[model samples]
Structures are given as structure tokens and as C-alpha cells.
Target: MWKMKPSIALSVHFTVLLLTLSSRGSSPAGKETFSWVTLPATANLTWTPCFDTFQCTKLALPLQYSDPEAGEAQIALIMSPSNYSSNDPNYLGSVLFNPGGPGGSGVSFVQELGPYFRAVIGPQYDLIGFDPRGIGQSTPVLSLFKSPPEALEFYSTYPQNVNESISSFGRFYAQANILGKLAVDRYPTIAESVSTAAVATDMLNIAKALGQDKVNYWGVSYGSILGATFAAMFPDNVGRFIIDGVFNSHQWYQGDWSSSLLDTDDALTAVYDACVEAGPSLCALHDKSSDLIRARVNKLIDSLHVAPLAVYDDSDPSNISFGVADYTVIVLQIFQMLYTPFASGQVIFEALAALEQGNASAIWQGSVTMANDVDLATCNFNASQPFVVGFLDISAPIACGDIIADEDRVRTSDEAKSDYQRMADASSTFATTWYPLSEGRCAQWPIKAKDAFNGSFTQNTSTPILLITNTHDPVTPMVGALNMSSGFTGSIVLQQNSTGHTSLSGFSTCTAEAIHAYFANGTLPAVGTLCQTDTRIFENPSNSSGYTGVTITPLKRSAEDYSLGEAARALAGSNFLAKSAGFFGRRW
Candidate 1:
């Protein structure tokens, strides 16, 4: 995973396309003052206790921004003041929240994490959670494939042979295009409606609707991109803003999803290296870290390519042979498991070991289920199929049509494929085994490289912003976060030395203390400050006992909480046939 630094220019290009959209009119400057326009309260509105002891309400905004007269989309919004006193006009403004996932649901995340936030921010700020446009409980929720089976069908049947790959790619694109059109037909203008730019405008509108002139914001993952876009468009109105798991604005639009994959591989290798240093007692591969673990895993994947392994029970109609793609899926799955030393050393090792024994069920069946559950709980979309379909439906038209231009489209599929292939080839030591296995869907999806993807944020405004990142995050990657930090003029970066998707929720006490201090008193941590948290703390499953002050429950024994276990089983079962299925199917 550790490699020499590569130029971020290409990555930046893709990010810009993902975030920056060229508006018919220039973005509203942060310094610009706008008056609030109040609308009559609607009967459909409902209220609940805020996550932190105050009243919260769900508000509806026009589904079509261009036509305010059009019907509305419901957004779950929670508000809790810094102080509980009845009279506080001088109240600190509300801070809108986003937990990421162009698809991640904010309401649920707030419910789970609100207490922690309340403890940190104290009684000085009102925290708000609202589902983004076209997401959870928000009107016109985008549901793609009906079941995980449908998605698994597509991913499992993806073609690997040159001719088959080409035809499969074509079919996948055509199907996705059709699906997007259907979603648009069902909810007209929805594609153009869900852009981050539109969402930014919506945030401002929400602030005005709540009788506030300005607002503070906290966004994670995709949420960060949303927040940054808002800051770019309305810098003057920007209050205290925090963006965690920062996404590079440039790489987003350029259609380089590969970077995220590479980041995962790099992160995994980092863990593997650490395991080697920690010695055999801590890492299964032990003295064989470099050769036995890494090499053996690669060898198993290669073996699967030659002779697919049968992983399902003969009685099961859904049983199939495992191939290369399954291998990639399992590898990706293992990438996340590395978040803990025990998971990395034990669970992942067992899974990999199973694959070496020619068993594919361990990898294929579990991954498919995890992917599906992620979609259901977070985005309320189907992940069984290529995720591109859901993303394209909600993203492409806005990202591609508005921000990126037709001229900027990558001239040919061959060109784009070649670029990706080159990156894969350069990383042949690992990429050869994993990259091809992972890129089946993106390769098949219809994407035209856009020029708008090449731009960068010129945050000329003086508004104070805070950026947080995990030093070893696999998903968003540290480099991308650093790129965003450098783009902002007065922004500060807080680095948490830990592993995981985002740094805010799970981090070192030092980092939490710094963030809490900032939220309470508007103090920014010094740039390049490092907060250390040992990720291994969670490795001892019993640690949950201390936190919850309850007995640790075995996953298998708790049927009520078996939702996670079942989902993992489903994913593993479905993906059992792909080339890399063994990687995910094996048990610890």
C-alpha cells in the first residue's frame, strides 16, 4: 500500500467534476447579504424531541427549485439550542448536519451520535440533522433494483473475457441509462435537483425558514463535499463550518473512482506492514507477512482465475462457481476489516486462509449482504447491483450535465480504460490481482470524462473553516483531505492518527477534546496537529462492555442484532461466484 507519491492532478480533475458545477450565474459570495423570505407553516409538518433535549421538526422544500410552485420534498431537520432556557434570541445559530453518503441518512446517524455531540458542544449550539435531497424520508427517494438478488445477478454475471467484457459493459450502461431515465420519469427534474449546488441552496433556504440569518454546518464524507460547496457559494453567510472525511472537489467530476480503491489498498497494506512489525503473536501471517500473507493471497486469487471454485451447498439453487471478480469484492471487504488489529489479524486471516483451501463461500456470501445492508440502512437504495446506477441517477446529470461539459468528455472509452489500465499495470504487484477484479462495474458504466472535473476551489473568503481527517482512512484517503485543506484560505486541518472512514465519531480523546473545544469556543486546532487513538482498543470485543456498562453479547447468540450477521451472510452468499469471492467468504 505504501508507494511513492503520485501527482494528484488527475485525481483533482476527477474531484472538480464531482463537486464544482458551473452555474448559469456565479455562486453567491459568502460575504453577500440576502434577506429571508418566510413561507406559511404547512399542516403536513411534524415535530419530535431534538436529539439533544429540544424540539425538532421536519420541513418540506420545493422538489423543483426552478418552480417553487411545484410539490415539496420532506427533509428531516432536528434543532436543539445551545441553552435550554425559553428565552434566548441571542442564541448561537443552528448548525445543519450531514453524515455523508451522497446516500447516508443523517437523521439516523444523529439519533445514534447526537448524545456525544451534545456532550462536546454543551449548550452553545443547536445541532440539526436533515436528509439530503432524494435521500431517506426525503420525498422521491431513489430506489434502484428491487432486491439484492437483482444486484448480485448483475455483478456476478459481469463478463471477463475481452469480447464478453465489451458486450457486458455495453449492456450494463444501457440498463443503467434506462434505469436513470425511469427515475427521472418518475420524479421529473430529480436528476438536476439533487446536485450538491442545489442542496447548498436548500441549506440556506432551511436556515432562512428557521428564522436564522446565518448557519453553522458539520458534514462528514459526502456531507463534507456538500458543506464545502456551500461555503464556496455562500462564503459570507458561512458560520462555523466543519468538514470531516474531506472529498477532493476536482477528482469527483473527472470520473476517477479508482483513486478511492487505490486508497483502500494502500491503507490495507499499511495495516499489513504494521501487523508484520507487531510480530506473529499479533498478526497471523507473522514472520511471513510479506511473502506468506500477501503472496499467498495473490496466488489464491490467481488460482481461482484458472479454475473457479464451487462454494454453495448442492441443495441451494443459488449456488455458483467463484471467479476473479469475487476475489476483488472479498479483497475490498477485507480492506475494511483492517480497521482493527484483531479483525485484520484474526477475521481477515481466517477468510484469506479459507480461500487458500479452495473455499469461496466465505468471501462471496458475506460481502454481498454487507453491501446490501449498507444501502438499506444508509441510502435506502439497492446496492446489489452496480452502485453507479444509483449514483448516476442522482449525480451524473448534475455533476456531468451542469458542472462538466460535453466537450470535456473523455474522447473514447478506450482512452479512459487505458488510463485506468495504466494505473493498474503500474500497481501490478497488487493491482493486477485486485484492480481488474474491482473495476468490473465502473468499466461497464457509461461515463464521459468531463473538463469541469479539472477545476479547484479558490476559497478567497476569510471565513474560518475546520477540516478533519483520519491519517489512515481507506475510503476518502488522507491525500484528498489534504488537497481540500490546502484549497481553503483560513481553514485548519486536524489529523487523527487512526483507521476508519471518518475521524469525528471514532477518534483519539485528544482529537475529540480539540473538536469539542472548537465547537464550544470557536477555537481552531493548530494546523498539522496530530491526535493519536489506538484503533486496536476495539479489537477486544469485550471493550464494548466497558463503554455500554453491560455484558458483551456474542453476535451469533443475539438473534435480534443478527441483522448485521444475516446481511454479511447474504453478501457472502451472493458474491461467492466471483473470482475473488474467497477473499471475503472465509471465516476467522
Candidate 2:
């Protein structure tokens, strides 16, 4: 699936909070400097133990930094100190990590990957993770739909065909989103303040609060956009920054969503090739051979346009029906799975094989599994608002805050359908369905950050930045990384000749080794370095975990999670259910 974008941009007052002499170290011209100091406790904060090794704290910063009196919002932060001896003279400083999604929970990211990071980055640096404003665990969390089920309902409203005839359904769907409408109406400030630039500023504030003089960062996907913004805004503070699955900051700020999805078609083809290469022993759909499998899959999708598939749902004790919209959602899920084909390969194979067999059980079963993973507290979904709004319900504002959108580019449902046709012509795999779907939603967003960065990308930073990417990343394509690298002075681009999203781990050992080296000593990989991917698509993983000699607990797949044959069920629904499951299950 494609990343979400806000439809419109409205100008609003911005608050710029600059760190002064007392807060920052005085460095000589063109050189980065930092003076460490502890932050005294404030009246507005509460600190609590997060885990045995980590402490969690909440800080209330001005909702609008430019207007301190406007109000304040709390952001959640979790920090774990380095295991290295504090007395060691060679102890490395703190490093900030972001897993992207603009809406992805950084707290969850740290909790899951901390040990892996500590091993790679060395235990000499503090690991810090925070939920960006309006995101997970942060104050004023944005919830587009009350629950995952509601999100599924919202997605269910999408028109199966792309044409002006179906525009009314889209309009009704947008207006019917009472929760979404209420959210935007109630908190306009968040919409205006959640841009990447603002988040980058938040990063700086986090560093200052932590008494760090310089910043070391590892950001992926949209996080790369934030890192780029941080580099542009506070160039001197930059230290050994690594941006993986690089985002084209220019494209992002300019609100060109289509550019990101242009490569999805090619990536999907690669998945097909990889599946064929795997053979029937490894790939569930391999019995039909590559071209035949594709034909059957396409036929299945086409057939759904005429009549929905009824899949047996053991829980419902009846058949669950899937409409064209539901079919599209499964397609998007397959596309996402292609990102980490090794881990998700089996899932994709089974899902598609079931589709070929006219069985809807696999799709319904996946939905139930996904529903179990969702946090009910975060999702306050009700029956009235049934939509599968992506992780973007919370993320779109941040995107709007960072980018300048052309109001004209924003489209009505009919216009969006037209746009979808053009996109489909270029890339059928994703553009046809996603373009129209996004345009309709984005057209309704009516705010933008006043201080969104659109300045010259060229800047004199304190150190060279490292850029990493996979050749066939479904979301952030490699070309964007190369384009971004050209703008940053001395930035090195390390291309991983692989298929996936981020290349730092599992996807490419060469890339991870290169990153480890850069972290140890701020030396860029030789320019034009092309790292080889060790994971084979169809073969058993040569190295299940990316680490050289470490074992990671594997995710268990249930025996009941099997391919469904042509069994009819009682329920009929759209593809949004599939996408809803993906909300908790990220392709990356």
C-alpha cells in the first residue's frame, strides 16, 4: 500500500523554538560543538520506570513552539543507558532511532529492537525513543476511526470501479466519517504542528533535554525525511546520521505522492519472479508455474468484480464474502509482504494460492489474526465510522505539516478516478486503486504548517551522512535515495542489490556491516558501493537473523493458518479488512 497524504494545505502561524547559549555548546564557525548538562526536573513532567533498564518520562512542550502561551502537549520518551562503563573515556554518546510510518510507535520500536541495536551500535551509547507529537503514546493521539473494525468499514466504502459514476460514494464516505471530521474540527493545532520539520525540532529538543551536545541518528522510510529535515535545520548538530530506505525529501515536501508508488509495479513483478523461482516445494502457488499463477491471480481479481468470494469463517460458523474492494486489499497486503519476502513469503504464497482456488477462508482468517493484535484502547472505533484509514490517520498531519500541496492537485472523487486511470496506465499493480483512494481522503485535509521547510537542500553539515537503500524497496525506491544523496554534501549512497524496504538488517549483511563501520568511525562507505543481498527469495534463509552469530526468536505460524480452498461463507466485505489487519502488521 502507498503512504498517506493530506489533501489540502492551510497556512497557520508557527512557533520556532531555538536552543540558545545556555542550552547549547558554543562552537566555532562551521564546526559542531556540544556541552553536556543535566536537565533539572520541571513542574509539568512525570517520570516512571518503563522496564528494568529503561525510564519513561512525559514532557509538556508548547503545542505551538512559536506561541508558548497557546498551550502545551505531552510527548512520551523512553531512554535506556548504554551498558558500557560510564567511567570509560571512550564511551560513545546517545543515538536516536525512528522506525518511520510517521505514525509508528517509537517506544514500541525501541522495546522490540533495543537489544539488537545495542549489539550492533555497541553498548557505549544511550538508546532513546520517543513518540512524536500526536503519535503513539503522545498526548492528543489522532484516531481517524475508533477501532480496527471501523477502519475496515471505512475501506469497505471505496468504489470498485474508477469513474465519475462512483464519485458520490466517495464523497459520502468522506463526509460520513464522523470521527475523522470531529478530530480535525477539534484539534486544528495538531494538524498545523505535526510536520517533519516540527518533529525534527522535537528531536533537537529531545537531545537538549537529554544533555546531548551532538546528535547521532538512525532513521528509516519517512524517518529519513525527518532526518533530512533535521540535517537541513540544524546542520551543525549532525553526527554519524544514517538514513535507510531514503525518502525524497523534496518530493515529500512538495506533496508528490505518486512519485513514491511509481516503482510498485516493477516490485510486484519481482515478487512473481521470486515465487516462480522458489518452486512448489517452497512457494505455495508454485504448482501452476509463474505465468499461469499470475494469470489465475489476475482472473481471480477480475472475477471478484462480478461477484464476491464467500470464505468460510470458523468463528462466524458461516461463509465470509469478499467484494472487489476486499480483493484489492489482499493485493495490497501481498505487495507489502514482498518487502520482506523471506519472513512474509509463506503468508503471501498461501493467501494467493487460496485466491486461485476461490477460497476466501485465508483472507478472513488473516483478518481475525490481525484483529487480535490491535490495541483496543488506542482504537475507539464504533459502527458508524467504518473505514480502513491507514496508519496515516495519525500520520497525515505530520506529512501535511512538512509539505506544500497544490490545492488544485487535490481532486474530487471523479477527478481522483480520472487520476487513477492515468496512474493505472503507468503502474497497474498499485496506482489504479490507491491513487483514487488517497486523493479523496487528502482533498478533505484543510491545514498545513506555516514553517514547512522548502529551502535549498544543500547545506554545510558538521559530518558526512550515510544513505542506504534496497534496489527494490516497495515504498521508498532506490532512485529517491540516490537523488537525495546528490543534494547533501559528502553524503554516501550505499545501494543494496536486494528486494525489500530497509536494508540495514536481515535484508543485507553487507549494508549492516557497512553501517556498523560507519558508526564505529564516521567514515562513509566508498561512493558507488553496491552491497549484495544474502537472502534468497525462494530458498530457505541462509541467515534468518541479520546478526553474524546471534539467534532471534522466530515468530510462530499456526497450523490452522492454512490455505483455504473454494469454500463459500456468509459474510461479504471489501478489501479494507485485509488492510485493517495490516495496520497492526507492518510490511517493513
Candidate 3:
């Protein structure tokens, strides 16, 4: 039982704060010099001041990194200065922070939580956040879809029945094809297109523009993938890089959706078990330890598949019944909310109890539609879902296909479906559904993959990268972290025994302290060293001090059995197991 101080004791450290503009290298002896080129910032670039008192600067970079001589893209760069800037001589470098979501805006995220960084990292380093290319403040952002309600309608209407699912798949594919064709006709992938590689280059260019030779980066969720890729590409330019919610670049490129889904499922089960073990004193769903929470939860999920529950609209009084898929989406959203216990736990437990009571408004309120405001024209697709599906669907055909003749093309649709089904059967129950959902969207989208996906991490470089992962993260599971650790030779792994998506700012005092020390001193934790987190810091709604209602649940045997049973039923009669057994059997 690892016990630490309560949440309030987690104070924001504000000592030794300093901020200084970078100057040109005077002598060039053990110093680097970068010519400062201050171009006109974009007009559309917007700035919302830091909520906790900080200054923000909007910067512009080329939309396409490869062709800097081409058109420009505007990015919002927010800088939170140290309190003691005038006194300190050795000013720590600017620590760029990214809260993931190739779509998530760093400017707003850090502006809101700037004080938290100041408290944890102290006042030495200036915390800077910039919206990545194709994201907020970055020009020509990816705003393809309509409102959240519209997006939900699109997603919810997806056919769950075999015949409808297949028809829906075709419709989606047609739409994507149309969209892709339009995109290609309108703007070809020139040297300056917005790609992950391009984003890495932009980071380096941003550092150079800021008049800094090396940068300290703190990237969460999707930001982890960006950070790792940047490190892989520009190793020497990395001063201190912390990548939380590890994204396996190999698995990502290879399209290993089934594996990723399994990982997520396992993490969720762990949460469920933890909640059960915490008992009635803590968790609302409290029952006897042997009461089998996972079984009950599964039963509730199955029941929804048949009858569903009508949840009252948060905004309106109208009640709406939700299907199993809707419930699944709610579960995914709750997984993220787990990071903020107080805000999520009560909501999750209440929703669960509601499901038991034939109501589901709590779940609906916290569903993806509500939480992400997904219907917004600015954001239609969730960032992680596409990546997961794309990887698995694209990788199998490429990995197992005859590459010489079919170099660029994937396996035939039928073949790919069969392969996916087989993989799902052998892996997890949700794989069948998840695999299709993940890849199905791409079927309609017109752009063909550049090449057969390969599970290879381009790691010939000598970059000192630091990889941080939570042992029980629901999104980018621990297995993904392990896969990343195995791939990046120069990378250091910091395994925090925490739950949720990111770990750097979301873990216990010791973990957070170690992260601060590493960023501040450029030191890496010992390999295989595990940082214990304070699991007691749940999201307690009753307690005004903590987040609304988030709680941690451990994975237990009953949950595993339930999940396994669900998988077996979902992948019944598909050749899924025969093909996937090779990969999934290793888990046993």
C-alpha cells in the first residue's frame, strides 16, 4: 500500500523562475548561433491569455515543412514565464508542452494548466506551447466534418447488423473516396504537406526561430508520438524530452488495431477491478469482492444491445435510448475521464447504476458526443480511432502480402476483412467491431496508403529520448509503451504505476518530482524502474477539493473472463482466430 500526501499537498512549485530572450552566440566557443528570422505572424492567429497569469505569442511556420519557401501556416505559441526572470543568470531553456490530439491545441491546454507546470517544474524553465500543423491556430486546420450532433448521427447510424454494417461500410468508403479525390485535385501532397514528419521538422525550425539550439519537450498522448518521432529524426537537437502515453511508432505505422484494442480492453478491466476492490466505502458500485463487477458490467452491456436505455438529455428534458455501441463509446470517454477522478468516477458509477436501473443519461452526458463536442465542424473524427484502424487494416495485407507486385496496394477488401475477422477471433471480442470501424472509415476516404504498412521504427539515429508510460493507461495502453521501449534503443523508459492517458503531470508526487528533475537536469531514470502513483487520489465529486468524480479500478479475473467471452461470441465462425492466434497466443 503506497500512501502519499492528499491532492492539496500537490502544490505548484514556483521558485527560481526566470525568463530571458535568447541572444546570438557571441564567441561560438561551445555555443550555438541561429540567425533570427522574424516573419510576419498570421492574422488569423488567435490568443487566449493564460488563465493563471502568463504571456502568449502567436508564431507562424510553413504549412509544409519540406518547402519552407512555400506558403506559411500560423500557429499559436503561448509562453508562461518564470516569476523570477530578472534575478537568475542561467535561464533554463524553454520547455515546449503538447497535450496530444494531433487536434488538441497546446496554447489553450497549457494556458489553462500553466500554473500546474510552474508549480511542478518550478520557475526556472519557460513553458511554451504551440498548436501543431493541421491543429488549432495552425493554418488550414483539418476541419472536415460538421457539428457534434451531426457527427454522432453519422457514427451512430453506422450499421451494427451484418447486412447494414456491410452497406454502411460501402457508403463510408464512397464518401471518403469522394473527399480524397477532392483533396488531391485541390491540393496534392507537395513537399510542404502537413504530415507527422513535417511536424517534427517544424518543431526543430521553431526551436531555431526561438534562437535555441536544443529544446526540452513534454508531449502527452498523440504528442508522445510526435515527441518520439522528433527525437528519432533530430536526436542531437533534443535537450530534455518527456513522452507520456507512449505511442508505438511501429505498431502505429503497421496498423495493428486489434492489438491496440486488446490493450485498451485490458486496461479498462484493470480499472473495473480496482473499483470493485475499493469497495462501497470508496466506489459507488461497491458490492462484495466476489460479486463479479465485470460480469455485471458485461451483462449490462449485452442488455443494452437488446433493449438499450433512454438517458435524459443534459440540455433538454428529452430522453434517448442508447445502444451497445453507444455504451462502448461512453466507456471510451470514461476511460479518458478517469484521469480526473472526481469528475469521472461518480459519473461513471452513476451511469453504471443507471444502466442497471434502465436509464443511461449519465453515460450519454459523458459520451464522446458530449465530452468532445465532436459535432463541431472543426472536429469530426477522434484522432486515436483512425490511427488504430488504419494501422491494423493497412499493416496485415502489407506484412502478409506479396510486396514485389503489390508494393503500394493493400490486400483486396474481402481478403483484408477475412484477415481482420481472423485476427479478432484470436485476439479479443471487440476486435471484429473495432477493426472494421478503424479501417472502414478509410475505405470511403480516397487516398491510398503510400506503401504497405511496416512495423518498423526508423531508429538508426542516436537520440537520447525519454519515454514515459502509465502502467494502467486506458488509451495508449502499457503494451504500446513496451513496444515503443523495445524499438527505441536510445530511449529511456519511465514506467509510472498510474492510470489514464498521460503520466508526466498526471502521476503521484514522486513520479511528478522525478519528471521535473529529469527535465530540469537532463537525467534519465534507471531502466525498468517503476514509479509508484497515489491511487487514492480519485475523482471525488462530494469532495470539493479533488476533480469531480474519477476513480481507479484494477483489472481482475472476472473482467478478463467477461471480455474473453464477449470476444469469442463476436468473432464466432470467422477465420479470425486461425490467422491471429500466432500473434495473440504469445499473451497466454
Cα lDDT of model 3 by residue, 1-588, tens digit? 111112111100000000001111111134332211222364333333432244544566665444556677666577777554634775776788766544345665554445556656666787887766544444444433233454444434443222223364455444435434434464443212455556677778777776778868887766776777677677668777787777666655444444444455555555666676666655656566534776777677666655555544334347432323354443333443444332244445655665576556555553433322322334433342211111112222212221222243334557555646654553443443444434333332333323222224546334467777777654466777777766666677878775545564233665666666786676677888787754443334322332311212212222223332232212121111111111100000
- For this target, which candidate reaches the highest TM-score against the unseen true structure? 2
**TM-score leaderboard ranking:** 2, 3, 1
Tens-digit lDDT track of model 2 for 1-588: 111111000000000000011111122244333211122224343445544456667676767767777666567766667766556776777788876766655665564445556555655687787777776556655555545556555544443223223464464446524434644686677677676776787788777776676789988777788889899889899988998878688877765566666566666667778877777766666744667777777776666655666543344447332322255445545654544554455555665566666665454343422332332324523233222234446555666455576554334656545645655665665554444334334444566774467566687788899998877776677888888888889999998877656664234556656776788778688988998866666664322222121112212322123111100000000111122212232211
185, model 1: CA deviation in Å? 5.1
Model 2 residue runs over 4 Å out of place are: 1-48, 85-87, 144-183, 287-290, 315-325, 368-390, 405-410, 413-415, 418-422, 436-440, 504-506, 540-588
Estimate TM-scores for all models: 0.69, 0.76, 0.70
At residue 505, candidate 1 shows an lDDT of 23
- The C-alpha local distance difference test score for the whole of candidate 3 amounts to 0.48
Candidate 3 TM-score over all chains jointly: 0.70
Q: Say which candidate scores most in lDDT.
A: 2
- Residues forming the 10-long window of minimal summed lDDT in candidate 3: 11-20
Candidate 3 wrongly placed segments (more than 4 Å): 1-52, 68-70, 84-88, 145-182, 185-192, 312-343, 370-406, 409-412, 415-440, 443-463, 486-490, 504-506, 537-588
- Candidate 2 vs candidate 3: the TM-score winner is 2
lDDT of 1: 0.49
Question: Residue 530: error of model 2 in Å?
Answer: 1.6
Measured on C-alpha atoms, candidate 2 has an lDDT of 0.56
